[model samples]
Target chain A: MEQYFVNKVIENNRFVIEDSETFKHVAKVLRHKPGDVIYLVDPEQNLFTATIERITDDKIETSVNKLATPSTELPIDVTIACSLSKKDKIEWITQKSTELGAKKIIFFSSKYSIMTWKKNVIEKKLIRLQEIAKNAAQQSKRRIVPQVVYVNKLTDLVDHKAQSNLVAYEESAKQGEISLLAQTLNQNPNSILCAFGPEGGFAPDEINFLNKSDFLSVGLGPRIMRAETAPMYFLSVLSYKYELTVK
Target chain B: MEQYFVNKVIENNRFVIEDSETFKHVAKVLRHKPGDVIYLVDPEQNLFTATIERITDDKIETSVNKLATPSTELPIDVTIACSLSKKDKIEWITQKSTELGAKKIIFFSSKYSIMTWKKNVIEKKLIRLQEIAKNAAQQSKRRIVPQVVYVNKLTDLVDHKAQSNLVAYEESAKQGEISLLAQTLNQNPNSILCAFGPEGGFAPDEINFLNKSDFLSVGLGPRIMRAETAPMYFLSVLSYKYELTVK
Candidate 1:
């Protein structure tokens, strides 16, 4: 069953899906007939079982009934701030991070970043990435789509810091800095954010700036993960620590 | 620093890079001079720093010296038995699984597998996937490359079972089964293997068969992950439990 995020909430047992894009998807693409059921998520983050009553010229008239589905959002909010990479890598990071329960996916330009978004193309790229995040969230059956963001400089990350901020440092893992990530999670911060560098890695001054901004340098593990792989690692660990494990 | 896996044990202080592929990579592609250094892993999984002594016609002579770099292999052996998916998904799974410390990557045909390996193309596909594993292993600086395997039937997974066998079942998670993944990890099993279903998921008969074969169905979380994303989640959680967390 496909789920769509509606722009408005259902006030009564009757609802109409009027968005042209969604109408085309539900009516034309899937070729769904009357009596077929789909999921609808409202702006208030509530899920409803929408059974198609009739297909009109522009609206999908549905009988809206709320269902007691378990929330798919993570208890501890997680933000993954990644340095800008190539087109495919960033798109992959966005899609996978959304599935792994990130609340916000932040991409920033770092010293060693491979491709930085130009001033004019930033809006179009963000719209495309936001579309990817929405599709992935829907595919994963998440309650809310994770917000995608971009920061122009490493210094901009300070404004979006969480209670527990971290920078994945490979050198620290090489030196056997293993316990900090676990210890930080043990503290049970309500929200946390982690930053990952590009293929060439962050410059020394960039790391220093983040460190001074209260972002602790943490090591994921012994093996070195690629720039895109590390964010997925962080998000999965978050889900395991908060959702899977018994607290 | 680049790393190459040699086919034989480096017995003495001097070694020659004889493999034609590695020779092409080091001598022709990278164009290394007499003083350039690279890391080499022998069949015994020993790490050695090889400094170039001379670059001959078909081989590169190097002085081998042992290095005290700590092992990057995970504490617990892991095997991921994923249902065969599209070419891109399986290739992505192989590369990421190697980076995350999977000892064996198994692909089996399930009732709902999207693509089944033909009798002819199996060998060629496995070779290409194995090459991906080797490259990812070298990139992530692992001591050993993960071996890729394929099975004609789901029952073949029994021959490759580990001490702890699990199948990621979505129904189990929907029933609110939590704490099993954590408790299983806490048991300190020496080896574990988990199977994942395809896009449409496993058929009921396949699940029943696996259940009868001592494969416990485990829920990842509340969210529904794609077939490819679930294995990465499993591998990342293993890395966190065995490598990052205090055990």
Candidate 2:
């Protein structure tokens, strides 16, 4: 079934979706005639099964049949704090990370980051990234679109109230460290923060700062992964260990 | 350090590379001056630390320093047989799957694969994808480039001799089944062949053919993934398990 995110409240037997853009998409683009079935998520985050009752140029109305169960959200909140890359790579990070069930994506311009987003370009760039997140969310049937944020430096990564914080480093792989991913699944931590580096990678001082902040240094594997692809690897492993393996 | 794949036989403390392309890459494109370091692999599949000794338009020569130990390739060779997608997505899969250590990539047209290569165009298309795999191999520093092969039908796939064969199905996800990825570590299968559907996914009869051919049905998760993205997920999970966790 085609799913749409609707900004409305689902009451006893009706959904009131009044967002103009969504109304236009549902009524005009979709060409959803009356009595056609569609899935909608209301403002309260309830997924409602509804049949189109009326189609108009302004608003398309649907009668709520029942609330759908089985939300596709990850069991634990995961916040991937990755160093910013060039525009296309960052967009890829946002899209794939959302599909793998990231709860938040925080970007920091690292000491060795080659690409810089000027202050003037920040707003429009963020809006574009957010659109990528929205489309990924809808495609993956995610209840929430992960938030995208930006930071200027290492110190800008303030301590969040996460149950665990990890930094994936190439050095750890050289040392043959076992994966911390499988071990971090205890009670499915309230929130997990994973940080990745940019092209030139984190400077030695940045690693020192992260070490001081009690971030566990772990290894993904032996072969080197590109900057944009590494964090997605981390999230996939984490998701596999926690979400897929558990009974 | 930059790495390049070289085919040479080290004899009497010297190395000779006969491939004309590699000669041009080293002596021409890289503009090697004597005493520069390059990682080379000999015909015995052994990694060698070679220092540039001579540079010529036809042949660049290097003196062998010592036998370098290559990281043991993944114990289980994994081959991903999937339908080709849009150019970028297919390139993404080829690059990332190489990093994840996939051994071979095969593509076949399905009922709904968006892109199609006709008989006249097959060789050129294969060459293009092979170049992708070669660049990916160089980027990830793999000992060999994964082969890119084209096969046209399910019957062609049934002739493979991998120890394990499987296919990812969204219907399995709908049924709340665990992924075949979870079996990677426990089973320690010697080689794996995994097939993924095209954009519209496998028709019911196609799924039945795979089932009848003894391909295990695996589910990724609740959320749907693009066909190209799905195999990378499988390989990433495999790396997490075998490369990081098991050893």
Candidate 3:
């Protein structure tokens, strides 16, 4: 079944999708006619199997067939906060991480980060990343699209509290500190926020600040992963630990 | 410390670096002179710390100071055989998987694979992919560079046997089957071969053939990962299970 993310909230067994992009995708691209069954995901991540009752110039009228349960969402919410890097690599991370079940993604400027987003460019970048996340979520059959947020500094992440907080530091890997991530996750944290450094990695001051702010510095493994690869590895391990190993 | 993969096998506490790529990297790029210390990785995945004694137009002579131990190599050998996909995506997989500790990578034509390698293009493709693996290995400080192989059919995998053979299947994920990969890995297999499908995934006939040929189907997680993402997920999970969690 075709799936879409709609902006409207589901109420009284029906909802109106007035977004022009979705309207064009359903009406023009897919050519979905009245009575075609499509899965619509609401803002709250609730999935509904709806039948298209009618299509209009500005809206899609859908009647709810039933509420559908999707197991694609991860059991725990994971937010990956990474320092901004090259443009294409960040876009790739947004797309791939969404498919791997990250609940939210936050990009911020780090002390060693080479890329910086201007205030005017931030909105455009977020819009592009959000689109990538939405398309990847729909393709992966995820009920909710991970939101992409931009933070101006690493210290801003201190406000994004979670049950478990970790920073992937390469120095920890060098010291052979293993199982901290697994041990932390073993406590059954309902939400996780994992931070990764930029191309050159986190500066000493950034690490000191994160260390003081209660962010547990964890290692991915012995090998040094590229900045873009670390978050994907983290999310994959989360899946294996929570979804695969526990059962 | 500079690292270079030398073609010469170490013997009698010395070896000559003759490969032009390694020669250019050490002699021209880094401008290393006599008495400089360089780490050389041989074909056997052994690391040798050597002092550069002389540099000539043809070769650089180095005397081994001592054998160094690099634990970047995984405990167990893993080979990822993926159905050939888009050119850049396959190249990306080769590089990333190598960094994540894959010992070998095999590319094959699948039933639903859109891209096919002609006989004439195979050698060039292999060379390109081999270069990618080599660079990634050096960047990740891996002891060994993964070998790239090409196969024509799924049945050809029988000759590349391992103690454990598994296929990443999306259907198994949809059915919520878990722990098979971790269980198989727990048996302490010295070598493992994991196969992933192309964008369209494996056809029913291909899955049936794999099922009959001792390849256990394993699911990564609930969400549908892209073809490129599945192999990385497999490698990350392997690292987490074998390297991190057990310790």
| Candidate 2 local lDDT, B110-184, one digit each (tens) | 877888777998898788888888777777767778888888875588876478888888889878877465864
Write down the worst ten-residue block by lDDT for model 3 chain A: A63-72
Task: List runs of model 1 lying over 4 Å from the truth.
Answer: none
What digit string (tens of lDDT, one per residue) describes model 3 on residues A1-247? 7688877677668777788998899889999899898888887777888889999987889888546455678999999999999999999999999999998999999888999999999999999999999999998889888999999989999988688899999999988888798899889999999999997999899999998988999988888789999999999999988888884
Q: Summing lDDT over every window of 10 consecutive residues in candidate 2 chain A, give the lowest-scoring window.
A: A178-187
Per-residue lDDT of candidate 1, residues A1-247 (tens digit): 9999998978899899999989999999999999999999998889999999999988999999998887989999899999999999999999999989999999999988878898999999999999999989988889999999999989999989999999999988999999999999999999999999998888999989989999999999999899989998898998899888967
| DockQ-derived CAPRI band for the predicted complex in model 1 | high
* Residue A93 alpha-carbon offset, candidate 2, angstroms: 1.1
Clashing pairs in 2: none
Query: Highest lDDT: which candidate?
Result: 1
What lDDT does the true structure give each of the candidates?
0.93, 0.79, 0.89
Off by over 4 Å in 3: A12-15, B12-15, B32-36, B51-54
User: What is the docking quality class of candidate 2?
Assistant: medium
> Tens digits of per-residue lDDT for model 2 on A1-247?
7677775567778765578866776777777788988888766667877788887667777788766567777878888988878778899999999988888898888888887778998889888998889878888878777889887777777645367888888777657776575566554777788888886778888988887887778888777788988887887776777667876
Off by over 4 Å in 2: A186-188, B68-72
Better of 1 and 2 by TM-score: 1
Interface RMSD score of candidate 3: 0.9
Write one digit per residue (lDDT tens) for candidate 1, span B1-247: 9899999899999999999999999999999999999999988889999999999999999999998888999999999999999999999999999999999999999988878999999999999999999989988999999999999999999999999999999988889887889989999999999999999998999999999999999999888899999999999999999998866
Q: Report the TM-score for the A-chain of model 1.
A: 0.98
The DockQ of each candidate is: 0.85, 0.63, 0.82
Q: Pick the candidate with the highest DockQ.
A: 1
- lDDT (Cα, 0-100) at A79 in candidate 3: 98
